[model samples]
Every structure is written in structure tokens, then in C-alpha cells.
Target: MVKTSMSHEDYLEAIVMLGGTTEVPVRSVDVANKLGVSKASVNKAISALKEQALVIQPHYGDITLTDEGYAYGSSVLGRHRMLFDFLTKAVGIPPEVAEEEACQMEHAISDASFEKWEAFVKGLDV
Candidate 1:
């Protein structure tokens, strides 16, 4: 897998969340709104994503994820969901705090460890 900065990963994830995987292309403005960033920030990140061949966009156009981009973004989003669930359901963390913490943890956790933890969580009766 290509190594990308966490910021790039966030952009990819945001794109996916905004339905970039669908036939309807996602607007850059939507991505900016989702991430609470400026349009220029989205533009800069989109440039980097284009260089990595993760997204396709024309001048002032909508964004669509390539297959690789979708897969990568889905993985990151999946990690965030899993961490959020564990934090809120098992650890009894507040939803607001868990959301923020899970976002940070999703980037730092190793794939192997996360897989094991996911399996463990699944094995639980709860």
C-alpha cells in the first residue's frame, strides 16, 4: 500500500463519506464542509490525491474516488467505526469524546493489533 499522510487519509475518508464511491461525484465544497476546512485546503489535498492517483477531478469539478482510493478510504473509515464502537460501548466513554479519540486512534493502531482486537470484540457475547 502507498504511504500517505494522515491529512491525506482524512481527505480520502471524507471523500468516501460524501459518496465519492457512487456514480454521483462528490463536490469539493462538500468535502470542505465535512472536514470543516476551507475550499483551498480541499483543493490542495485534492492535488496531492490526484498525484497519488487516488481521485479524479477536472477544473472546478466534482471528485470521484478511484478503486484504490475507495478501498483505502473504506479501510480507514472502518477502523474509525470499530474504535468508536469499542470506546463507546465497551469502555463507557462519552460519545463526543469517543468520536474524537477514535479518529486519532484509527490512524495510530497497527493493522495486526486492530484485527486481533476486532476478533476479540466479535467473540464477546455483548
Candidate 2:
């Protein structure tokens, strides 16, 4: 698998979020709106993802993730959710603040550290 930058990861996560539960087509505009980015930016990011074989979009068609893309996006989403929960519940941070911070921290956090943090947070409930 190709190593992705934080920006690429963000785009992948946005695509999954926009698609939600349904397998409906997710357009570039939808991804742009979700990420608050421009269409051009989305196009560029999507191109990179395509090169990595993580996403596929036909000419003027809707965007869709490949199997690898889905797995990667899900992992990123999981990290974001876990960080958000930890920041808000364990650290007593406000939801808005935690949300923003978690988004930034999710890209930088390592899997080992994240697992430890998640375990510690869950342990508090037991």
C-alpha cells in the first residue's frame, strides 16, 4: 500500500463520511462541501487517490473507494472518533474544542499510543 499524507487521509475520511450508510454515489462537490474545500482541491486530491488505486471515478462520475480505500478510511474515522471521545470524556475538554483538536491529533498519533489511550479510557468505565 502507498503511504498517504495527512491531507490524503482527511479526504478519504470525508468521502466515507459523505457516503454514510448508503452506497449512493458521492460526487466531488459533496466531498468538497463536507471538507469545506474547493472543487479544484477535491479534484487534485482525488487524482492522487486514484493514482494510489485507493479511489476510482469515471469521467464525470461519482467517487467511490476501493476495498483498500474503505479499510484505510475506516481506520482514520475510528481514530478520529476515539480521540474525540477521549478528549471530551477523559480530559474534560469541551466538545467543540475536542472535535477540532482530535482532527489535528488523529493524523499525528501513532497506533501504539492511540491503543494505549483508548485502553486507558475504556478501563475507566470498568
Q: Which candidate is the best by TM-score?
A: 1
Q: For candidate 2, lDDT tens digit of each residue in 1-126?
A: 566999999998988888732255589999989999999999999899889988888876788898888878888898999889888888899999999999999899887898997798788872
TM-score of each: 0.94, 0.90
TM-score: model 1 vs. ground truth: 0.94
Assess the local accuracy of residue 37 in candidate 1 as a C-alpha lDDT between 0 and 100. Answer: 97
Q: Please give the lDDT score for candidate 1.
A: 0.89
Evaluate model 2: give its TM-score: 0.90
Write model 1 residue lDDT over 1-126, tens digit each, in one string: 676889999998898888779455899999999999999999999999999988889988999888888889989998888888988999899999999999998888888999998899888632
In model 2, which regions exceed 4 Å deviation? Answer: 20-24
C-alpha lDDT values of all predictions:
0.89, 0.85
Deviation in Å, model 2, residue 41 alpha carbon: 0.5
